[model samples]
Target chain A: MSGQQSTTSTSIGSRLLDWSLRGYVVLVFVFIFAPILFSVVFSFNSARFPTIPLESFTLHWYQTIWNDPDVWTAVRNSLIVSVCTALIATLLGFCTAYTDYRYNFRFKSAYLALVLLPPTIPLIIMALAMLAWFSKIGASGQLWSIIIAHSVLTAPFAMAIIRLRLNQMDRDLESAAWNLGASEWRTMREVIVPFCKPAIVSALFLTAAVSFDEFAISWFVSGLNKTVPVLILEIVQGNIDPQVNAIGTFVFLVSMTLVIVAQIFFTFRAGKSFS
Target chain B: MARTNFSGFATTWRMPIIVWQVLFFLGPLLFMIAMSFFLVKNYRMVEAFELKNWEKMLTRGYFWDSYILTFWLASLTTAVTSLLAFPASFALAFKVSPSVRRWALFFLIIPFFTSYLVRIFSWYVILAESGVVNALLAHIGLGPYTMLNTKFGTLVGYMTLTLPLVVVLQTFALANIDRNLVQAAHNLGCSPARAIYAVIVPLAKTGLIVAALFCFILSFGDFVSPYYLGGSKPPTLPILIIDTTKSGQQWPRAAVVAVVMMLTLISIAFAALALAYRKRASR
Candidate 1:
C-alpha cells in the first residue's frame, strides 16, 4: 500500500513538471514572436502611429510603398548587390573549403583562421576600414564596392557551412571516381558538386540574405546608391511612417520564404545523405 | 606534364581566395590600424604617429562606463537567453516528436531571416509608450511607463534577437545526448528533473559554454539594439565608436576603442575555452 502511494505521488510530481515545461515553452515562443507578429499586423493597421486603441485594418501602407519609386530602386539595388555577392562568396568559399579539406598542407590552421577572422571583427571597425581603403583606391561610393565588401563579410559563413558538409562526405566515393578513369575535374563535377548541393544551396540563401540586409558597410560604402536597409534608416531617422512597416513586412516574408525553401531542401537532402 | 599540371590545379584552387582575403580583408584591417596611429591635426590626418587618441580613450571615464555597461548587459542577456532557451530545447529534444521538432526549429529560425534592422525597429514600435506592452499594462490599470528608449528596452531587444541562436545551439546539443544514459538514470530511481540536471547538463557543458560565448560576443559588439532601444544617456561602445568616427572623423580614437573591444573579446574567448577544458579534465 505504501509503495502504491509513493508511486502515485511521484507520478503526480512528474506530471506537474511536464505541464510547467510545456507552459514555459509556449510562453517563450510567445515572447520571442511578439514583435514579429506585431510588425506584420501593424503593417496593415490604419493608424499612422502604429499604436493602440486597436485601429481598423487597411492596406494603405502597402499601397503607399508600392507607388514609391525610391523603395523600388533601393530594392533593385539590394537585389543586384546580393546576387553578385552570393555568387562570388559561395564559389570562393567552396573552392577554399575544398582545398583545405582535400590537401594536407603546412599552416592550414592559420589559413583557416584568417578566413574566419573577418566575421569576428566588429562590423563598425571593418566598415570604417573598408570605407577608408576603398576611398584610397578610388572604389568608394560604388555598387561594386558594396558587393565586394559584403562578399568579404559573408564568405566566411559560406566557407564554414561548406567545410562542415565536406568533412562529413565519404572520401572513398571521390577516390573510386578517380580510380574508374574519371578525370579530377570530372570526379568533382559529377560526384563532389552533386553531393555538396545542399550546402551550396544553403550557402546561397544565407549569403544572399546577409548581403540583401547588410547595413553598416553598405551605409558607409554605397554613397549614392542606397540599399533598402539604408533607405529604411533614412526614413527611420526622418519620420514615423507606417509604410516602413509595410516594406519591412514584405522583406521579412520574402527572406523567410527563401530560408524555409532552402531549409526544406537541405533537410531532405541531409536525410537522404545520412541514410 | 599532365600529372604535374593536374597536381598544380588541385593545389592552386586556393589562390583566388588567398588573394581576395589578402587584398580586401587583411589589407584594410592593417590600414585601419595604421591610420589610427597617425595624428589628427586641424581636422585632417597627419602623417606623423601619435598615441594621443589611445591615451584619450583609456583615460576617459565615458569610455570605461560604456565598456562596463556593455559587459553587464551582455552577461545579463547571456543569462536570460540561456534560462529561456534551455528548457524549451529540453522539451523539444525529449518531449516532442521528430517531425514536430523539425517544424518547431523552422519556426524558430524563420524570424532571424528578416532584416535585422526591421527586427530591431519592430521592438521600438511594440514597446513604445502607447504600444502593445504599455497598452496591455494600461488595460490592467498599470503603467504607460516609457520602455522604448531605455536599458530595459535594450535588454528585451537583445533577448529576442539572440533567442533563435541560443535555442538552436542548445537543441542541437540536447539532441546529441545518449538516450541510454538518461534511461539508466531513470532505472536507478532518479527523477526526470534530477536526471536532466545531473546527467544531461554535465555532458552538454561544452556546447552550452560555446553557445554562451557566442551570445556574449554578438551582444557585446551589437550597435543596432543599443542604438535603437538604448537611450542616449550612456552610449554603448559601438555607438561611441561610430559617432566618433563619423562626426569627428577621429579614426585613431575609434580604432583605439575597436582594438580594446577586440582584445576583450579574444581574452574572454580564451578564458571560456580554458574553463571548458578544465571542466573536461576534472571529469
Candidate 2:
C-alpha cells in the first residue's frame, strides 16, 4: 500500500515538472518572437501606426519602398559594400586559416587571437577607431572605408567557420597526394580546395549577411552615402514612417534566408543531414 | 625545388592576412589611442599632446553619470537575462529530444539574424501609447501607462536583444555538464531544484559567466536602444561619444570616451577570466 502511494505521488510530481518545463520553453519562444511577428504583421497594415483595429491589409508600404529611388540607391550601396566585404573577408580568412592549419609558424596562436579580436571589441569602439583612422587617412565616409571596417568585423567569423571544416578534413589525403609525387600546387588545387569549398561558400554567405546588417560602423564611415540600416535609422528617427516597416520586413526576410542558407551549407559540410 | 617552393608558399600564405590586420585592425586602434591624447584646436585634431581632453572629460559629472547608468543598465539586463535563460536552457538541454533541440536552437538564432533595428522598432511601436500593450491594458480597464521613452523601455529592448545569445550559450553549457552528477545528487535524496542549484549551476559557471559578460558588453555599448527608447534622459556612453564626435566636433573628447569605454570592458573581461581561472585552480 505504501509503495503504491509513493509511486502515484512520484508520477504526479514528474508530470507537473514536465508541464512546467514545456510552459517555460513556450513562454521564452513567445518572448523572443512576439515583436518580430508583430512587425511582420503590421508591415501589411494600411494603417499608418502599427496599432491594430483589425485594419485592411495592403502591400502599399512595400510598394512605396520599392519605388523610392533613394532606397534603391541605398540598397545598391549596401549590396556593393556587402559583396566587397564578403570577398575581402573570405579571402583573408581563408588564407589565415589555411596557413595556420598547414604550418606551425611562430606566434601562430597570437596571430589567430588578433584575428578574433574585432568581434569581441565593442562595435562603438571599433566604429570610433575606424572613423578616426579613416579621416586621418583622407578616406572618411568612403565605401572602401566601410568595406574595410566590415571586413575586419566579419573575417574572424569566416576564419573560425572555415577552420572547423579544415580540422575535420582527412590529413592523410594531403600526405597521400604528396607521397604519390604530386606537386604542392597540384595537390592544393585538386585536394584542399575541393575539400574546403563548402566552408568557403558558407563563409561568403555569413559574411555577406553580417556586412549587410552592419549599421554602427557604416553609419560612422558612409559619409554621404547611407547603407540600408543607416537609411532605416533615419526613417525611424524622422517621421516614424510605416513604409520603413516594409523595408524592414524585406531586409529581415533576406537576412534570415542568408543565415539559413549558411547554416544549411555548414551542416552539409559537417556531414550532418537534417533528417 | 618542390620542397623549397612548398615552404615558400607556406611562409608567404600568412602575408595577406598579416598586412590586412596591421593596416586595418591594429592600425585603427592605435590611431584612436593616439588621437585621444591630442588636443582639438579649431575643431581639428592638433598634433600636440595634452591632458586637457582626458582631464575635462573626467571632471564632467555627465561623463561619470553616463558610465554609471550604462553599468547599471547592463548589469540589470544581464541579471534578468541570465535568470530567464537558465530555465529555458535547462529545458532545451535536457527535456527536449536531440532533433527537436536542433530545430529549437535554429529558431532561437534565426530571430537574431534579422535586423536588430527592426526588432527595436517593433518594440517601440508595441510600447507606444496607443500601441498593443496599452490597447491590451485598456481592454482590461487598466493603465494606458507609458512604456516608450523610458528606462523600462530601454531595459526591455536590451533584454530582448541579449536574451537569445544568453540562452544559446547557457544551453550549450548545460548540455556539456555531466548528467551523472545531477543524478547522483538526486539519488542522495536531494530535490531536483536543490540539485540544480547545488550541482548544475556550479558546473555551468564558466558558460554563465561568459554569457553574462557578452550580454553586458553588447548592451553597455549599444547606441540604438538607448537613443530610441531612452526618451530625454542623458544617453548611454556610445550615444554620448557619437554626439560629441559628430555634432560637437570634439574628436579628442570622443576618442577619450571611446578609450575609457574600451578600458572598462577589457577590465571586466579580465576580471571574469581571472575569477574563472582562480576557481579552476582551486578546484
Using DockQ as the measure, which candidate wins?
2
Task: Name the lDDT of candidate 1.
Answer: 0.83
Distance from true location, Cα of B112 in model 1, Å? 2.6
TM-score value, chain A, candidate 1: 0.93
* Highest lDDT scorer: 2
Chain B TM-score for all candidates, comma-separated: 0.94, 0.95
Report the lDDT of model 2 for residue A273. 21
What's the chain B TM-score of candidate 1?
A: 0.94
Please give, for residues B37-60, the per-residue lDDT of candidate 1 as tens digits. Answer: 778889887765778888888899
lDDT score, candidate 2, position A258 = 84
Model 2 lDDT on a 0 to 1 scale: 0.87
- TM-score for all models, in order of appearance: 0.94, 0.96
DockQ of 2: 0.73
